[model samples]
Target: MELIARATAVVGGTIAFLRRMGSPAHQAFGATPDIPAARKQGIMTLKMPAAEGWKDGRLPVCAPGLKVNAFASGLDHPRWIEVLPNGDVLVAESKEQAGPPKTLMDHAAQATMRRVKAIGTSANRVTLWRDADGDGTAEIREVFVENQNQPFGMALVGNRFYLGNTDGIRVFDYVPGATALAGSGEPLVAFKPHGHWTRSLIVSPDGSKIYAGVGSLSNIGDQGMEAEEGRAAIWELDVATHEARIFASGLRNAVGMAWEPVTQKLWTVVNERDGLGDETPPDYLTSVVDGGFYGWPYCYWGKTVDDRVPQDAAMVAKAITPDFALGGHTASLGLCWMPDGTLPGFGAGMVIGQHGSWNRSKLSGYKLIFVPFENGMPRGPARDILSGFLSEDEKLAYGRPVGVTLGPDRKSLLMADDVGDIIWRVTGAS
Candidate 1:
């Protein structure tokens, strides 16, 4: 019976793929469409040769050339990271307090998102840091925004700063040389808030469209799809027109997204469905296509249907499987493509911040991974570029990386840790 079931699924997936071939959904889920073949090929040629100095363990102190620097300190629960024009870094501190420890039985039956609270503690705040004197250290740190209700993602376009929170989208004018929110501008798009309140924002490469990531409210089909207003999808809103629509759907939780420099394609790191044991479904990093469905409540990965829910055969037929799986429940977030001519070994590579996990019996993730790209596409496997955030014994972890971005220098990497409430900078060793 098992063999027959597997065979049926394969046959169904193949047929579905064939039927949807050349369709708009197919084109969106397909590989880099606009990139030139020659440049893409060149991007694939770059090799990440191992360096003798780049070891696996944590450094004694934050130092340059070690690819690790503590840029800011004393944060409550920093969740998202964004770099500004003057080289200042903005961090969103979720401020949600950790609940009491749970037993194995509680974890087995509890909902992952239920126990977690979106409301922040009194420490909830946004901070901005700038390194004065070019000493490679942030000497100035100021609180920019306060009393915010669970701010997650932030984007800066032209003179305005767009913020995505649990409530709705808010905008403020960028006050140059102003560190505090005293002179900050007013709010912009105040729409009806939806599920998975942590919405990440990004602008199109040309800055015409503003995209926001909305995660699913429930673990599976618990929050009925049709009943929920705006959940489990990416929404694209025109900056000039303020027009909004569902850009893509069926993604469990697309926490992070960024446009590729060479290919101009949007890629996302997803937090897949949970509660199906330890390894039932795997988190993924893939290209986001317009109107694409990525197997959420009904199906997963590509063809694996969720037996728990009433399967939608028509929707599953159009859902695209992810390009690459980043193992189960790694909590992948904040994906960015390393531009060409920026770093030597990581040209056109994808850097993902694994926020770690609380579901599995044994803890996993809690590090930064480099997914190499060949010809403007992800290569075979992802390699761990930064580890040691969690102890080997699994007893304790210092940080939970939520967001990652390239530094203003364009040669370094910056990661935001919500658990430790700090920002780490990574650069190549001299």
Candidate 2:
């Protein structure tokens, strides 16, 4: 404990050390995490590193037996990546639109994001990248879709291509190998898109249903529940009828979604609500359940009541606990399944891109990680796939990874770094 205290003092000056003086981030990990008592600091701990992007061929430090390089760069805040059936990569480039901060905390939050260049007029476009030569770099770049409203999620199903703007999902006529859509898309479903604006999309294995994650309008319903209607839940849409229904509720900010190969279960990484100190309520990775309520506003971590919100006993009683904790404020956003043998020296598991944390004193995640799985369950501790995204002093972050997907080559991994505006490709070292 003395040595840890000594280490925290040098981590990120004084504020960081004070925040981290409670406990190391990793202790609040795994299925059964060490969740300390909740104490409302009412203070947002911002420990963002100065955004110093990659320069002069610098790259994120890869784990042993792995190498990393830019597959595509010079993007406009690419937030999500989707690999098409034809192996074409589509990037959803966007940023938060500036709005008046309602509180002093909100004001400071906005200032921090503005300094990091995280908020601006969004590009509102999807760009396509083609690595025709398979040399791991995109030689062809094209604007596939434009005039979007904070687009994030995308999917290609049969002849229909689905793209998610903050407000709704649009479907377009698409053909395999086609470079771009000919015209506008038809609206499939409308969502109340405001606070947590990102709408992540994924298709079920049978292709009969599509799932979209919609987040709450305010943290802990601070803006009132009336403003949070039809949000903080995963909406499942029927492909044939365009009908949508809530699949699961109380997922604060569920982003990444993927199917585990062995069990074929849907899984997601959720960014939990903050302000309850750093370690109490943790962001998590969990399997989604149909008609399940995981608790939000009123409860957290399976019936653990949050006194900040109006108490709802029935809601708390029904709140389901998540499967695994990914550390508080790590902002685990991007997730994808990596099959065994796809990358050398790794087994079948999930690859997660933790976009790092701003509300924590000590940074939690700004790198790619792999969680090993056995029989469709996480079997062991997470291993670092990529790291060194920040300076040694933890005061300078070069990049923050968001969306992740398997590359077309089947042997490489592609990740979108929103801060760096680059698509990084990782492959086993020769």
Q: Best candidate, TM-score-wise?
A: 2
Per-model TM-score versus the true fold: 0.79, 0.95
Backbone clashes for every candidate come to 5, 0
- Tens digits of per-residue lDDT, candidate 1, 1-430, equal 2343244334433433442242222111123222111111111111010111213544423322355767776777677888888888888887433234254322222223222222225355678888877655688988888776677778877877788876567777777767866644455554335445578889898888888888876677674766545778888888887778889988888988988666788889888765553344667888889999898888877767777778889988998978877765678887777766555555468889887765443455677887778865787556666776665555445566779988878878788876555677777766
Candidate 1 whole-model C-alpha lDDT, 0 to 1 = 0.66
Candidate 2 lDDT by residue in tens digits, 23-127: 554547887888877878665566667678888777899999999999999999999999998899999999888677676556656666655668878999999
lDDT of 2 at 101: 69
> lDDT for each of the candidates?
0.66, 0.86
